[model samples]
Target chain A: MSAVRVWSKPARVVLVVAGVGLGACVLAFLGALFLHVAPANSVSKQYRAQVDWVVYPEFEQNWKLFAPDPLQRNVAVDARVQTVGPDGTVVTGEWRGLSAEDWAAIRHDPAPSHLDQNLLRRAWDFYESTHGEGDAQAAPGSRGQLAERYLERIALQRTGTGGGRVIQVQLRATVTAVAPPAWSREQVDTAPHVRELPWWPVQDADREGLS
Target chain B: MTTPAAVRAALPRLLTTLAPYQAAVVRIGTAGTWGAYLLREWGNRRVLYGDRSPWSAELNDRLLADTHAFTALSWSDGRWWFEAVYLLALLSAGAVALGWRTRASTVLFALTVLSLQNRNVFLGDGGDNLVHLMAIYLVFTRCGAVWSLDARRRARRPGRDPAEWGEPRALADALAAMLHNCAMLVIAVQVVLVYATAGWYKVQGARWQDGTAVFYPLELDYFTPWPELSGLLGGSLLVTFALTYGTVAMQVGFPFSLAARRLKNVLLAVMVVEHLAIALLLGLPFFSLAMVSADAVFLPTALLLRLGGLLAVQGRAAGWWVARRSGRTGGAAAGEPVEAVAGGPVEAAGEPVGGADG
Candidate 1:
């Protein structure tokens, strides 16, 4: 016995209309994604307004996947917190390696999550990309502010209020050059260099969600 | 008929004539890869995006307020809600992989992935971006038309012949097919664009041009998971130069190779091997896997079927051997037909499946 056909004329009509609309939407989205990832140029600028809405937040992609040059330096993020004791004595904690912690977490696992591979690195990149080489403070409403807040949040999350009231947090990046390829006889300096950020006062805003 | 009327009449017929198996290929590749990734990273869900994340919901909300990137974490600042969202995402991914209620499940899967990815943007790499793009495109494709629970259910149901379905149903199905075909073509183009763009950028770089580009990455301590292996490989100057030049050539030539079946297949095989090496040597398995999955769209349906058949034969042989060794009859293992195991449209061999031109 033949089964009944469920889709009526009206239902099919609705389906066609919806399909057309959805198809157009998908096409538009694809165009936006293409334009968003394409190199920064005058052509891309034309579609920037339309593309930004589609590519931001989730779909914001960086296609520089090991292009031009790969990372040749191992960077370690170190943080030191100064806490005020009951007697008003300023006590500073030893430098804790934040990037080392991330490295340790990811080293053994073959399929480390994107977070393990990128979080600390991207956090550092966010800071570096936003701030000038010698800039002390991030400009308000700029990308630097976002990076500052992110770093601050990371600091607060990592170093909790276990010790005496934390007064200040100082973060620095230690860069060590990787050994030169065995094939290349070029003697590259493998020494560690430190770039220190100015000590940031632990503000009420920084500690907002920590409690 | 006049020219415009003839073209109009022909277009619908052309769309309906096309089958959905090609779309199914893309769906299986993307959904299956994503499902596996989700399952593998299940334990890290909380660490990646939940309350344990360093960036709080408030911080993310403040930063991403203008982007309208509303996440489940931002919706309710509770651990339970985060867990619920994670669970829903996991379930939806599985459903998408199984192609059960695929149309709805695809949407749910995309939203869940987006919400989680956006919640902690720092945790993702290029793989996540590719997944985002694929997920959006998959929604428009007739992805569950084959090798799916939906397909099985439909097959089981006693259905009227095409004559009884009437013209409206036929028209709707044709339109759907047309959209799926178009979406699949777009996906192919996207993959090509990625390769071409990457190649274009690489060509402009002095390092890539100088043939020392691959040398630096090999020397990197972070990427050198196996120092000894990297050293052995990087020690050979010829190998390094060959790899650097080959990568650029393959990437730049990919779009052109797509037109030629043999060259495309050869290039794809080389790429798969290259990605595998990267996964093993560089410790970027997910990224390699994601790229490999994307490349699967270019593989012919006939080739896939042959590979499937070979695997099935080997599996059955192994099962039969195990049964025999255990002093039991291999009848049960031998009873299942190889054809059943090698599922999908075997008759549609040499058919243009998942190819952009097709």
Candidate 2:
């Protein structure tokens, strides 16, 4: 059988076409990644706040994946706000310490408290009634929004000095997970160096100083 | 008829016969897969376009700024006009498939497709990127030479040398093959890394061993298209345990399967299902597509050539008819061998070769 030879012109054209297709896919992939970087008000937004700050000084490590969930993945975080006032006041506050067993569970499973039956046992029935079963994963930010609108019932209040006002702030923060074991103690210490919180309009100066 | 002598004598001829078949299969498989992908993408391009952030709105975004490599294209404009450009690319790809002015069309198609794919890699639902990569490799091959309009035209021409149409004579077939081989390698490596990473993460968790961990993924409401199924599967402690352990095993085992064909295909099928399930349940369309396309490398070239044969048969028939009809007048076509003419009606070797044999 006779064979037909392919010439340079057609070859060049095919390569050009293939190159274009590849280029387009590449662009699309990058665009999607860019979208992930934008702040979103979606339910996923709550996962963002769990990340107090992304560390890595010279190199910003984009953690592609972590144990549990990508969003719930723990980075070696170092968050140091002015725990007191802007006046450099030394501070002491109530910090919830996780027991060894609780610490282990938190490290492995970072599912939202609303979902876990045992974690939010005290308010399980109330939570089940108000929210759907396993809705604890709604995330802190979204939960805060919902709580503000509907659940105005603050179960606790704090009375400090100065103006002597009781701050009815809801406590939703919990130790969801720990940094990966691959992150050594020393590495975690030096890795995420937190800076002082910048001056913003302090919504509640007393709350900021205390909480 | 010693075994060694027979094997040595037959090897070259065997390889020679196989090359065309292999090339043909590659053309066919590529055409089908790429054709399907292009059609789907084009059909959904409108939705994709609607989903995109307007180019004007995100001109100064940090991601775009960081991609200084595209500075020459002056992409620093309003919005990243992803959808508009992608539509143009799909049209170019169709033209390439038709083999209309094949060389130019293929190049244009590749560029446009690659650019669009790169622009929105994240949003891709299925194996579109892999298909794009395959298309790129196909462009460098003799794919358009056989099943394309280019082949039809060339076949019609009176006396063009067959050697001229051979891909390497013009485009260096070996280099093209090497590029394809490299792509396959990259794909394999990437798959290995993904599985390895996932397995590593899973093994770290306590529930992976206890079998309780499966419920978490199953219970992910976002992906609970059929909550009952998740409930059933999630409640099954044994299935979850097996899944955790098996996932890591399969990932680490994939690279080893490449050594043999049967094992490779089996592993590849498993990989495909894994990705398919991810796409169906997790709504991770992009990852699924990229992974599936990568799996195409495991597909043997022989199958591809067979598919190409099916695609090119009509062209082949038309070509043969033209050859037979033209042979009556042309005496001898440019590449017709001496033996072929000798075997023709002119029994006498002394007769002059006319236009039909020219």
Candidate 3:
């Protein structure tokens, strides 16, 4: 490469010092990054907060892409809703396969949009992580309620406001295991397991765009 | 060995602009990937980031407030705000990819990447993470030095030498070069960490150990965008096992192979092909594109130069055909600057085969 340019001797020295400092900072950052991304261990655990401060938000790393084990099951999100007519007759709607639409949009398309690939999946995952087996808030007042809100927005937006004034919405997932090839000896139960979530009452905020 | 005279002699090497092509390719790669992805998702922008997003602005704001995270999306939950940031991201990605006003655009590139990706972190995959990291690192690089519009501006300048510049300008240029080298170094290290960690995690999986990991994902509805194509590929148990074992081997051995040029090139080629397969088979175009581009950081300058040459030749032929059809002459104009890009800096003293530069 052509030389960058020339600086005076003292200028060179100062720049060199600054460069050295920058290098050290980068090294420190890399160390923190390694700790943050590495599987939980003693040293990383010891410096958890410090590492988080450095690694969270922007510099955070997650290299575990289909690692340790790839996701072996197909989880499809389904939603249903209750609606009130002009005569105050409440109607419970059929469970709509929200995720089935996603798969339909995805199938045969080489470049599926993030809306189809991640919106329902990630929202459902958020809800799953925050809620317990009984559908109670696993960590109430933190992010559980927020996760529920996120899921409700996604599912309601996909299924629409139940043909009239919406009253309540509920979601569930059908997780089916991918069957192994005939040649392989590996045997996994190819059964579809359905998990129903608690019904969340439709809020004023949920009605804003439903019309 | 540590004499003052020797130290003084080598001190100036710090200011030398290193890996200009690597920087250019990375700039092009990351920005191209991001720009294409955004365009591809333009129809779904509202759902991905705007009002239709499952994670609403108020939710994003609350989450950001608790985590103390950084996202311009949290600035306002309004559709107008989301639209503005999305537009800016699209523009920045284009400008950075084209290397137009590169310094400012690179900063914008970083901001847009962080703002968009961090807004709804769960929406991304492994490739998004790499793009996220690269956008930040690319800011610290003098990535516009070669194959850039900025480089063309410099080439067209009255005096094309930094040495003839004013004192302050020269000093800044030197300092910038030093920073660029360091940034490139860090980028290289980051890629190594990614591979090492991925490899480490893969080796621990029982399916990976038993050589069946690659076969399972191909059958899943989510990953199987092309079921027939996937079925054809996954039909052979031997082929599946080979791909499985081969992936594990390549990833784990990648860091060690870096020091050996041929081995590294082979690994890089495999990685690039592997990413291409991921894009097609798994239907993760953006992720695979991001990864392939990130891997550009490790490519030697010579190979890039050769590739640039081939592209330039093709570009000239296309230009010639267009100009002929338009009744214009001098199609050779398109081929000239590519020479400047290839002949850049005379390969920089040939620091070993493993050096980031030629």
Which candidate number has the best lDDT? 3
Q: What is each candidate's DockQ, to 2 decimals? A: 0.40, 0.05, 0.60
Among incorrect, acceptable, medium and high, the docking class of model 2 is: incorrect
Second chain alone, TM-score for each candidate: 0.84, 0.57, 0.89
- Candidate 2 colliding pairs, count: 85
Per-prediction TM-score to the true structure, in the order listed: 0.84, 0.45, 0.91
Model 1 residue B215 CA deviation (Å) reads 2.3
Worst 10 residues of 3 chain A by lDDT: A202-211
lDDT of 2: 0.41
Give the per-residue lDDT digits (tens) of candidate 1, residues B1-358: 4799787555444354243555666666666667777777777666568876667776677777766775666888678998898888878877877678888998898888788877877667777778877887788777776656566555555355554556566556556667776777777877887788777778878768867677777766456566677778878888888998999999889989999999999999999899899888877877777788778778877776666466556756765565565546434544334334333233333332222111
lDDT of 2 at A56: 12
- Point out the worst 10-residue segment of candidate 1 chain A by lDDT: A1-10
For model 2, the DockQ equals 0.05
Give the candidates in order of lDDT, highest first.
3, 1, 2
Clashing pairs in 1: none
- For the candidates in turn, chain A alone yields TM-scores of 0.78, 0.23, 0.90
